[model samples]
Target: MGSPSDPARHLLDLARSRPPTLGDGRLVCIDGPAGSGKTTLAASLAALAGAPVVHMDDLYDGWDGLPRVTDQLDGLLLPLTEGAAGSYRRYDWVLQEYVEAVTVAPAPLLVLEGVGAGSLAHAARCTVLAWVEAPDALRLQRGLTRDGPQVEQHWRRWMRAEAEHFADQRTRDRADVIVDGTAAAPPRSPGRVT
Candidate 1:
């Protein structure tokens, strides 16, 4: 078993090559700020891995739900990690409530993308974790554009929550790979955190 030397083909390839005992033990995490290209990267990896992808946005209770969301995710992923089907209620941003709990079947690889996806507890159970980052200005710009102008105020609140979560969880510090979202093209090489 050798490490993947190329980052061009697919992140899935690199991730699947690493293991933590189980043959199908792989949880690919794409954690980063809003508009940092986590969704795009997760989609690409999912295409290559044929794995199910779940977003943190759907699980968050609200704009300032980062702390709570981590607990929710931890509860959901715990059972799923041990080859058990688990369920979670997706928070409806428009309605501002959890509608129903969606059932998630056990799979070899699950792509979890969004802020706090690769949190300390989650990362400990993951086979490969990727932490994505981009310039603050670019991230804010992308968030404003993607989420619409109405969310500017919410974005500010969310940023504060994100800061607290990251500082405490140390998600980026423990990542197996660091992805630079600012690159015009998908990163050709994994990054190193300063």
Candidate 2:
């Protein structure tokens, strides 16, 4: 096994150590504020575990979709918990609406990644809930760089919305692991589980 400080290794070990919570599959939720590297972490963990990732970005309705994502997750995860394949309609950002449906077949491991991916509604079913975070300034900068300055207003609103959601969810406090998004190396001493 790799060092426990390696987030991907730590998460994979955590997932394998736990009983499957999403039917025969284990769910690893990589959740955090926008631009905080949740996607990066999810990709790394998915690669390490050979898991399929369901991005919450695809489930969100639009700019104001954060609050409604829990319901969307319920729609996606409930079927999986019943040992059936799950699916969700992917939202097209350019079209500003939901379009095609994507099916997720139950597997040994699944990575759920995004802002509301660790909501209280499905916390009980998460085999590993990891919270990644960076400073607000850095996160805002990252968002603008990726999304462009044209969406700055949208980013601002989203940051505010996510802040409120995280507080309400108490996500960090409940995390099995807490990763520093700005760290140059894999996180060391991730909280709680370590």
Candidate 3:
């Protein structure tokens, strides 16, 4: 692969190709701390790959749910590798509980985006794992801005969970691609394939 200045397009190419380094069907994980740009990258890649995405925030039980959500992510995705529809319950943060079970039809490529999406519990099963990281200060500001005043306290708590989870998982060292989330993606027409 050429050194792609646009990290998102590069990742989109990776997803479209389904590189052999990955096992069977695509299980791509975009992981990083909150506001590290995992969501943005995932969206760009998903658009290019014509893939459905699973956001870890929807699976999280709460601010301290980082470690707990990996199992659920694994359960939701593992079935797809064997040609079954993936399903899971979405946890509502405001309600502080799981609300609905979402069904994701099996596809050639599946994207999981958010903090802890690449946790060790299921990283081995992923076809491709991408780590998007940004400066802590910038990430914190992005998070606070996105989440707004309501989540200021929750953001602090999630920050602690992010540190502990990343430390335990050693996610960066193991990633197949390291993306500088701060950089803007160059424009490219999406050639998504089913």
Candidate 4:
């Protein structure tokens, strides 16, 4: 195995030379707990492959809109699997309305990023599934900071739900690649804290 510096190269090589265990169609999913940097990694991978990404954030309808996400993913992102124009209705969080129609054309590789990006619910169509795993304490701190105090209650509830979802779904365990998203400090000494 190689080092973690170039994930896209790693994935591409895996896709190209993989044995018959993995299937075809070039779709990769990067899933994880919130704030695990799935989006950042997916963007990097997409750029490396000269592929486009189908961001799940664009499909979500905020805290109350999750149930509708699967529909959007099916309608918008999945079409790209066949090199079609992907189109879906996006929800406007601020105005609290279903906003505009966004369209994207499929490519050789497509990076799907977000929670449940690799869930069994979505995996039947994915060629590769990658999970970015981070410690819960670290992830919660990052998510809380990003979400801010105004949405403290919302964040807390979402975190609980996410925990439950991961437990039931086993998304990380089923991943083809596991990414470590801890802070960029040297590997901690066995007995040290920081």
**Candidate 4 local lDDT, 17-87, one digit each (tens):** 54321122467888888877787778878887887787776677787555457788777655665557778
Clashing pairs in 1: none
Give the Å error, residue 96, model 1.
0.7
Q: Residue pairs in steric clash, candidate 2? A: none
Candidate lDDT values, in order: 0.74, 0.88, 0.76, 0.67
Which prediction has more favorable lDDT, 2 or 4? 2
TM-score of 2: 0.94
- Model 2: per-residue Cα lDDT over 101-154, one tens digit each: 899999999999999898899987898899999989999999999989999999
Residue-level lDDT of model 3, residues 59-160, one tens digit each, is 888887776786787678777756777788899977999999998877777788988877777755676678887888899899878878778888888888
RMSD of each: 3.2, 2.0, 5.3, 6.1
Model 1 RMSD to the real structure?
A: 3.2
Best by lDDT: 2
**What clash pairs does model 3 have?**
none
Q: Alpha carbon lDDT of residue 143, candidate 1?
A: 91
Task: Name the regions of candidate 3 deviating beyond 4 angstroms.
Answer: 16-24, 184-194
Worst 10 residues of 2 by lDDT: 185-194
lDDT, candidate 4, equals 0.67
Cα error, candidate 3, residue 134 (Å): 1.1
Per-residue lDDT of model 1, residues 34-111, tens digit only = 778788878877876788988889898988778787677866787787777767788898899998888777788888
